[model samples]
Target chain A: MDFFFEGYLLSHGNVIGFIAGTLTTISFLPQVYYVYRSKKTTDISLSMYLLFFFGVLTWLVYGLILGSPPIIFFNAITLLLSGAVLLAKLIY
Target chain B: MDFFFEGYLLSHGNVIGFIAGTLTTISFLPQVYYVYRSKKTTDISLSMYLLFFFGVLTWLVYGLILGSPPIIFFNAITLLLSGAVLLAKLIY
Candidate 1:
């Protein structure tokens, strides 16, 4: 808790959870960045993104139910990140 | 219990976990297939796949520690799938 005294407060477990969750959640960014940079998405699969977004959405719900801030926060961000990729796959 | 009596056995919670896990794990296949089909990997990020593989590996270890069948099963598959993608990104 003191680690957050400067600004934020999170349990050690939550901090660990956030670390793991951040790693997984942000992993999607590179793909999105690739697409954004290349402007080519035909090689990417729409079905994959669709299924992935669905799964992430479910995780967000599960996190809410579980009252896990790390899970909820990371999944929410992932949802948006995945949604952007899915949109790119559609638009480009 | 009855669900598995015919051939397999898994609790309802496990069943649900498996369903969600399957959706996320199998989602990696499409990208792998795309890379396999197109053989174009310049746009994809090596860092992203590297990070992803690491994250999945952690999940796998966590699953093994928890003795959660669905987590173990899915993370193992995801490791392979993500590994395949990472390999493809490297190879092609």
Candidate 2:
């Protein structure tokens, strides 16, 4: 089972990772949209999201240094998504 | 500069990574609390968070298989935080 899973991930890992990362990262869309629609970020914490955004940036650098494709790829998407949410929170 | 950056990451990478990862992962707390307090996840997308949650799980597995400490640690924390948000979204 492990072997099969590994093989599946290895062959399709990049594609899956990309899709998953894209979808998950963009998941913030609904929240951002609602926040925009409502013009409220009352519940969102600025400091936390800022820190998290920076952390994601650092991780992206880490991935670049380590030459890890998935890390780099996922972090890139996550950064964008997280950043968008943070921006929306700040704006609204 | 690059060397210094690499060395910094090498020496304090794990620690910084942990802190960043923890902070970022837990940043969801405010959102969750807000959603809970307001009793609304109207802006939140269940499918997106669910998929992202699963994606995080898969990445955790990928990190484990790759034996990457940062990946493992960060993903572990992220899983918990994202999971919490997902649960809160579902419950409230």
Candidate 1 local Cα displacement, residue A46, angstroms: 1.4
Q: Candidate 1, which segments miss by more than 4 Å at Cα?
A: A1-17, B1-16
lDDT of 2 by residue, B1-92 (tens): 27647776766655755665666677776766666678776556677578778878877776666667876787787788778778877887
Model 2 bad stretches (over 4 Å) = A1-20, B1-7, B10-13, B67-70
lDDT of each: 0.74, 0.71
| Model 1 score (lDDT) | 0.74
Candidate 2 colliding pairs:
none
Candidate of highest lDDT: 1
- Residue A69 lDDT in candidate 1: 77
Q: Please give the lDDT score at residue B63 for candidate 2.
A: 68
- Minimal lDDT window, size 10, model 2 chain A: A13-22
Candidate 2 residue-wise lDDT, A1-91, digit = tens: 2775777666665565566566666666666666667777655667657877887887787676667887688778778877877888777
lDDT by residue for model 1 over A1-92, one digit each (tens)?
Answer: 13434233222334544455677788988888888888888767788899988888877656655566776788899899999999988888
Candidate 1, A6: how far from true, in Å? 32
DockQ comparisons of all candidates to the true complex: 0.27, 0.43
